[model samples]
Target: EMALASDIGVMVTTDPSQAYAEPLHAWLFGEDQGRYLIAVPEGGVDPILRAAAGTGVPVRRIGTTGGAVITVNGQGAVSVAELKALHENWLPVYMA
Candidate 1:
C-alpha cells in the first residue's frame, strides 16, 4: 500500500527493533529496490528521553551492505560529524 503510493517510505516507530525488520521485508518484496529510506531515532539510554540502552528483547541482528547511510540525532539536531565518521568507518566495512 505505502510502497505503491510513495516514491519513498519513512517509517518512524517508537520501537527501533521493529524498524529494520519491516524495511528488510519490504525490500524482499521489491518495494525497496533502491527506492526507500529507513530512519530511526538513536537507540540509547537517556532517562529524560525515554530511550533504551544496550541490548535486550525486541532487538535482533541484521546485516548491512555498508553503502547505506545512517544519521544520529540528539534533541532533534543531527550530530553531523559523528554521523559522518560513523559512516566513513563503518559503512564501507558493512558493505564490503
Candidate 2:
C-alpha cells in the first residue's frame, strides 16, 4: 500500500531474477530480510547511490513513480483507488 500511503503510482520493472541467480520458489509470497524498495525524487538518486557505494550496501533503481495505476513490468497491478477502498472497507467487514 505504498502508493496509497504516498499518493503516487509505482512501477516495478525488476523481478526476482535480477537479484537471484536461480529461481526462488514462491518469491512473490516469500519475504527476504533487509530488502527494501525506496522512491527517490527525480534527479536526486546520485547521492544515494554514492552513499550506498561507499558503505558497501548494494542498491539499484528498480522503479519509477507517477500516474495513478501501479504497474509491474508494464502490466497494471492495481489502482490506488481500488486499494484505498479495500483498505478502508477491510475493518468494517472484519468487524461484521
Candidate 3:
C-alpha cells in the first residue's frame, strides 16, 4: 500500500550494514499495505543521526532513495527473490 497510498511515487535504497539489510528486503517484496519505496535524499538522515547520537542509537545513511522499483539508487544491492529462490530451498523434517 505504500506505493498506492502515497500521494507521490516512492523509491527505496539498500544498505549493506546488518542494521538495514533484512528490513529492506522485506519491504521490497511487501504488497497490499506494505512499504514499497522511499526517496531518501543525500544527507537526509543527518538530522536524525544527530538527534540519536549518544543515545545508543546507531544509524547510517546507505542510499538516497529515488527512481523506479528496480532502480532504488541504493548502495548495497540485494539479490531479487527469483534469483534467491533458485539458490536455496528448505523443507522441515519431523521425528515421531
Candidate 4:
C-alpha cells in the first residue's frame, strides 16, 4: 500500500498495460496514495512523448492527479466499496 509504505512517486501502469492492472490501481491508490503516473492506450502519449522518447522508454498520460479520489477516464470514480466489490468478483482466483 503506497499510502503507508512509500514516500515517493510510483509508476502506475505500463504501455500495453496488462488487463486489470490499471483499473485496480487507479481505484485503490488514487492521488491520496501518492503522486502517480498511469500509462494509457496509444492515443494518450503526447504529454510524456518528448520527455521519454530519447530514453528508449514509452510513456503516456492516462489519469490526472486531483483530489483524494479514484477516477477512470474522468467519468467513473471507483468508490472504496466498489473497489471491494471488484476484488471480490475478480480476484477470487487468488482467494481460494
Candidate 5:
C-alpha cells in the first residue's frame, strides 16, 4: 500500500504471488501507466518485470543507482554522478 502511494514504488518480497499482485494491479488499472520499474537484486528477477515489459512498461536493473535517479521507460541510463547529486541533495531532506 505504501509503495503504491509513493512517487516511486519499490516492492521487495520473497513471495512470488504477493510480488505479482501489485504490479499486475497497476498494469491492469493503468495506475503506473508509463512508470518504470527499477528492480533491485531480488526484484531484478521478478516476473512482474516481464509482464510489465510485455505491456510496454519500462523495467530496468537499477539497484546500483542507490534509489537516486528517477527513470521512466528504462531507455536511458542515469549516470552515477547524477545519482550522487540526487542522493546528496535529497537524502538529507527526506531522511530527516
Candidate 6:
C-alpha cells in the first residue's frame, strides 16, 4: 500500500498469474530472488527499461498510477481508507 500512502493508486493491467510458465501460485507468493517491482515516473521509464535491457535484466510495464483505489485488471479494488483503517487498527484489534 505504499503507493496509496504516496497519494496514488495502482492499476495493474497485466495479469500477474501469467508471470511464470507454470505454478502461478509459486510466482505470486514465492520469494523469487532478484525480482523487483520498480516504480518509474511517466516518460522516465524508457531509460530504466533501456538500462535494464543493457544489463540483461528483465523489465516489464505492469501498471500505472492514479485514482483512490488499487485495482488489478479492473477487478477487485480496495479503497485507501479501508486499507488505512485495517493497518491502523490491526494492533489494537489484535490486542483486544
Clash count of each predicted structure: 2, 0, 4, 0, 0, 0
Per-residue CA lDDT of model 4 for 40-94, tens digit only, reads 4455557467767877675445443333335454545545444545655776766
Candidate 5: residue 49 lDDT (0-100): 67
TM for candidate 3 is: 0.35
Q: How would you order the candidates by lDDT, starting with the best?
A: 2, 6, 4, 5, 3, 1
**Candidate 4: where are CA atoms >4 Å away?**
1-48, 79-96
TM-scores of all predicted structures: 0.19, 0.74, 0.35, 0.33, 0.24, 0.78
Name every residue pair that clashes in candidate 2. none
Model 5, range 40-87, lDDT digits (tens) per residue?
455556786688788986555423233423333443445445555565
- Where does candidate 6 stray beyond 4 Å? 15-31
Lowest summed lDDT window (length 10), candidate 6: 21-30
Model 1, 1-96: lDDT tens per residue? 322233222222233444445553353345533344333334432431332223332332222212222222112333334455565679787888
- The whole-model C-alpha lDDT of candidate 1 against the native structure comes to 0.35
When sorted by TM-score, best at the front, the candidate numbers are 6, 2, 3, 4, 5, 1
Q: Tens digits of per-residue lDDT for model 2 on 1-96?
A: 578897777777766557664354444334579877677788878998899999999988777899887887787678878888898899999999
Residue pairs that clash (backbone atoms under 3 angstroms), model 4: none
Instruction: Write model 6 residue lDDT over 1-96, tens digit each, in one string.
Output: 566478677787766555466564455345668877778789999999899899998888878888888877788897867787788899999999
Cα misplacement distance, residue 60 of candidate 3 (Å): 3.3
- How accurate locally, in lDDT, is each candidate? 0.35, 0.77, 0.44, 0.47, 0.46, 0.76
- In model 6, state the lDDT of residue 50: 94
For model 6, what is the C-alpha lDDT against the true structure? 0.76
Per-residue error at 35 for model 4, in Å? 16
Per the 3 Å backbone cut-off, how many clashing residue pairs does candidate 2 have? 0
Residue 46, model 5: Cα distance from true site in angstroms: 3.0
